[model samples]
Target: SGSFVVAVDTDVMGRGSEELGKTLMKGFLFAVSQLPSLPKTVLFYNGGAHLTCQGSASLEDINALADKGVDIRTCGTCLNFYGLTDKLEVGSVTNMYEIVETLAQAGKVVKP
Candidate 1:
């Protein structure tokens, strides 16, 4: 099968009340963790970086995905911009070059 990659650019899925969005994101990640075949990598940036930070409700699901060998990478610039560099809990930091390269190399790129 072709390699699959995911790029997350938001803290939530839709433009709705903040509470509902976070709830949906949590459920989405939980469902991703339960997938029999997971993506090759998951890239988090912008507001999505918050999902991988400490105290995030989605941490457990993200951690489980990481533990399953999915490459989890978050934008360093994004983390720094949000003052969350020290709070990253589940992934390594990546730069724009690698991010672009990763997306370029993937057979499919999924954004959610």
Candidate 2:
């Protein structure tokens, strides 16, 4: 087991135009990527899963995190429900069982 921080990106941040929201999300991910000790994993569910899929504005940053050894996982059920399974571009697909276990074993679980 290892330390972990969970990022639950629910609405792309802020409350305004979708364009602004997307920009904010990109900035957030970029900041996260600059962290010295990055999170062990990033779990995306619900709308957050969109950040790990095709056409995401923050895909480059997310891909950087993945290259740095972060476990980027998007909810499998969510992708299917949202019809984005084939559109995924980063990370791996994960189920609730693993999600629950990962969160439970994490040293710090952060929802953002």
| Predictions in order: lDDT | 0.91, 0.85
lDDT of 2 by residue, 1-112 (tens): 2386766656477787887877777888888889888899999999998889888888999999999999999999999989999999999999999999888888998775
Off by over 4 Å in 1: none
Q: TM-scores of all models? A: 0.95, 0.89
TM-score of 2: 0.89
- State candidate 1's TM-score: 0.95
Quote the RMSD, in angstroms, for model 1: 1.3
Give the top-scoring candidate (TM-score). Answer: 1
How far is 91's C-alpha from truth in model 1 (Å)?
1.2
Off by over 4 Å in 2: none
How does residue 51 of candidate 2 score in lDDT?
88
Which 10-residue window in model 1 sums to the lowest lDDT? 1-10
